[model samples]
Target chain A: MSSDKNNINLKLKVWRQKNSQTEGAFETLDAKNVSPDASFLEMLDAVNEDLIKKDKEPIVFDHDCREGICGSCGFMINGEAHGPQKGTTVCQLHMRHFNDGEELVLEPWRATAFPVIKDLMCDRSALDRIIRAGGYISVNTGNAQDANNIPIPKPDADEAFMSATCIGCGACVASCKNASAALFTSAKITHLALLPQGRVEQDQRALDMVAQMDAEGFGACTTTGACSAACPKEISLINIAKMNREYLRASVLKKEELSGGGDG
Target chain B: MLNFLKSTVGRKYIMGITGLVWMGFILGHMAGNMLIFLGPEAFNSYGHSIVSNKILLYGTEIALILAIIGHVTSAISLTLENRAAKGTRYAVMPKGEKASTWASRNMGAQGSAILAFIILHLITFKYGAHYETTVNGVVMRDLHKLVLEVFMKPGYVAWYVVCLLLLLFHLSHGAHSVFQSFGILERKMQAPLKKIAWAYAAVVAGGFLSQPIYVFLVNR
Candidate 1:
């Protein structure tokens, strides 16, 4: 609500840790002279500079390409994932949304599956495992084919596009009551299955992706919709339902030999 | 203990365990109810076998009552805690449509609906001639006739059908979750658990509703 850019000051309860093995605690710091136009990461950068000048170790947090596109600058801002804005990523959030002199609680993503690396950094490699198991078109490589060759309908393409927009940031897991990765895994599966290129691997994709998801120790989706609600990318929970449908269909089609796992 | 309850993980742990216990009761109850479709003789014999064994019947009923009480109490507590954490919103128009499942989000509403049906079921089916009527030196009720008579009415049968759908909705989301929450649902069990939940839900819904549908919609 403050139109005047000058009078911004805030307190941040930032979580601090030297390493994953070491214990951590919330270290309070003053966010001084914060510009209204500064992105949330830029504000953090300013604070880090202050800490370095005072002969203190800078707060460790992950950020690459301070733009929202990288999906790296995610941490719980006052118990809400990606800060208070409904759909804005942490990198995209501006100082204006917060009030001057407000105390903000910042913490690393807390989920059993997402082990903290140090401070706000986490090893999101579990998500990568899910992707590796199955998240791609499996067709043999060839030169570019015409878009018309696939003949994908507009509705299907739109749905696929929406699902494919998932940044794999693990916000869904952090926000979920069950810590489910269903939204992310489902998005990857649904995105491919909606297109002709991915149809060849539809059953395989569903089976492998789901297997990997379960293996990663992430909880199942209970349809609470918290993940979708907290997602900075605004990913839909409908993909979870779509994923369920695909899994069911694939299970029905799978032969007894192929039922266990792998391309039998 | 209070600190544990206040933590996010603690609250979820409570919700998960209690939720699973309730789901277990529903599955058992639905399984027993499915026997009704096997015909009056099969269902009545099954019912009499259980009810006639007074000790077992009493113990089972007490356990069921406890499950219901625990489920409702925990649910109320969790709801209150969440509401207190997230302050009242001030949106003038509506925000965008919520992405929650219809069944999961509407637990209280669906629970209330199911509770109404439970009371009605107790009054008309449980307390009516089906139970506690005496002759000479004994108490007895014709279970087969009671079922037939209950389903014979168009309005009563219609209500049964409606309640069965609600029960299905409740069970669909609740079944797999109970196991998952307790960390019992393993990687190997994922497919089977989901399948069993879906199949069990369908069979219960179909089997129980069919009794009334057969009497009112089909036979008539």
Candidate 2:
């Protein structure tokens, strides 16, 4: 729909909430004569600037680096996570994607684990808690080891690198019909489990992270596959399968250890 | 070990394993059902042979019952937890963004239909009239006559066909998903598994559906 026109006038329907306790609703406003080259966040900034000029509270949303690298900013644009484009985060979405006079809808991630904090921002600390459960390695770090001290196979390293690319963005959870965090949780598990350095605690890491994920009140993954489809990093759903393998193995081993082979 | 059952992944693993058990049962059941094509002598003899072995028949029946219980319980709990996870609903839901199948989304509804069908089927066939038929000068339960009598009625035939169709939808999703849930299927195997699932669903449904249609055509 991009043409000779340099600017597109749009109608924005943004979700606004006072806090988690209060009810929320959509606030429709005019986004007039916006430059097509502006990023989606910049367009929101323009709208907020106008609200401020009219003696109204500017729209509140979470955004750190307007760049797509940081996982700080994410909200549903229309019905799709991070807007209509595939593998494009909201921060990287350009206004040129929309046509003139098109009505755009925006809302925060709607999951029990993520409660609304303000207008377009929701509390995503639930993800942080899952990571804290065991998303790290416990190696001693007095001094940096030589680069080639521990050899990693290319395939394992590649797969591990892919899994590690997860930005902790809540898009997978938002896009899933079940609001499942399986993709996010599995990404962490698979990333660590694949590396030699992270292998020492792989069993415990899978167990604790999955236990923490369930405790966080997230839903079970039914393999609907929307999470991987909507993932900005294109995180594979295979990771979830790998995570399941890890959890099952660790659980049986732990049970054997606990019962001292009596159960067997 | 009990704590594992409480976790979401663990519950799904149970569902997967139990679903596989059910699939195996369906395959065996379908194979046994094919004896109807061999006429009354073979069909009745097959029925006689199954009922004659009391321990093997009862043991298999008990195992099937346990599998059903496990599958149904995990399904109900998982569905409730999934609903709770989605705290709020979107005002406008746009469709066709993803490649999700119709069967995958409505698994609960399809499963409920299958459950209802199973109850009705058991009452109609297993506990139907106790008529006796002489095969090779030996009296046995007339299961072949019962099947012919049931299939002759248009209403019963329609119901059976409808149930088989529901089963097709259920198996179309269940077969592939069970392997994925158990974490055994690899990335490269997904496409082939999906194809195999569709083929299995078609074959099972087709085999079961042919009986009533064949009986109706011959008797009419």
Candidate 3:
């Protein structure tokens, strides 16, 4: 143990893959005298810096907006999504959480739908496909409305806002055993379905988006609660139950066009 | 509707509903079988009442078979789908107290074992040996003798108990999972309902388990 706790050396077991088409393997690297306050990604950058000086290929990972709002930079750390700290993204995680000398394992998200593009970076565009299906309100204009114009119940607003917190990170898929995207899809569904502004195409939104999710080849939800626990934003599982209700309602009832309230 | 029927959520609904059907029948069957503890006369008459009406008997049998078909078909389809969805697993997996339970993870295996047991059960008692007896001036199938004979065999009794344990495992996860698939749970009700479902599973499975051991011991 150093008398001055300014610097700590650690071992990292990082996954290394050339590209999406190639096989990947783990490589052990030394991270020497790293600052305790450095973020996890910063530590990775330090290691990459050393690798470059040694004439080795620098480790490649996805990262942006180190503040954790960008929804980028997530991978399994010691088999845990976004590392051991609860509800914290890798960019927000600090080196002080680890032991003076610890070995960490990092891997990309695993799912048939999410193919690994490289070490610690998998293709999450399947999530984009789901949003493209029906993740928006039918707005006449993109401009903001007067905040007081619409009277939304406090509970409903809370529900919608809670669901809206999902940053589209793929940690839920990374943590799930079945690799289901129920949490992510449900959050999107609930984010729109709970507000009057989004009520117009609510039924259609549920149907098309869920269908798109299935088409992406994600597994059926096992309701294991791992996704909620692993979520960096702490999204609730109720969003999933609500989404199921919406899908069922849209499938069973809810005529496509109401076109009503008239005497012909 | 067809799209709903074919979706992953749709299959889950089918599995949950059909599973409920079987759970209802299990409770009824266990209660009816307990008539043996009353006496052969009581047991034989109870069996007679069920089989005397051909329409009702056939109707129950048909519904039960249909439930089995739906449950098993959806189960197999979901199993194949889940296998494909897992893709390539991580070399390093989360250890210690995972979010998935043994029952939730191995529902396919538990359900398959229960299905196999059901077939063997029907053969042993329902179609095994039919003895006739006149009770209260009405002749009826001597189901009591068949049940006693079946339970008297230690091998059959052991197999039956193990299957009941498997049923416990299947129901422990499935009963509460139905609420999730059907979207009938309130946020506050999830935990309490889960506990209630586990209790229900234990009671039904334990009830069935009690009968065979009791009969086997008496026969010995």
Off by over 4 Å in 1: A1-5, A256-264, B1-220
> In the order shown, what is each candidate's alpha-carbon RMSD?
12.5, 3.6, 3.1
Tens digit of per-residue lDDT, candidate 3, span A123-206: 899999999999987666578988999999999999899999999998888888878888999999999999998888899999
- TM-scores vs. true structure, each candidate: 0.61, 0.94, 0.93
Candidate 1 CAPRI grade: incorrect
For candidate 2, give the lDDT.
0.88
Residue B204 in model 2: lDDT: 92
Candidate 3 chain B: worst-modelled 10 consecutive residues by lDDT = B91-100
Tens digit per residue, CA lDDT, model 3, B3-90? 9989888888898889889888888988888887898899999888988889989988998999999999998988888779877777
For candidate 2, write residues B1-220 as lDDT tens digits. Answer: 6878889999999898888888988888898989999988999999899899999899889988999999999999999998899889777564564435678778899899899989988999898888899999999998988999999999999988988998998898888887777888677987899899989999999999998999998755
Off by over 4 Å in 3: A1-8, A256-264, B96-98
Superposed by TM-score, candidate 3 places the C-alpha of residue A233 at a distance from the truth, in angstroms, of 1.7
Per-chain TM-score of chain B, candidate 3? 0.95
Clashing pairs in 3: none
Cα deviation at A48, candidate 1, in Å, is 0.2
Q: Model 2's A-chain: what TM-score?
A: 0.94
Model 3 achieves a DockQ score of 0.62
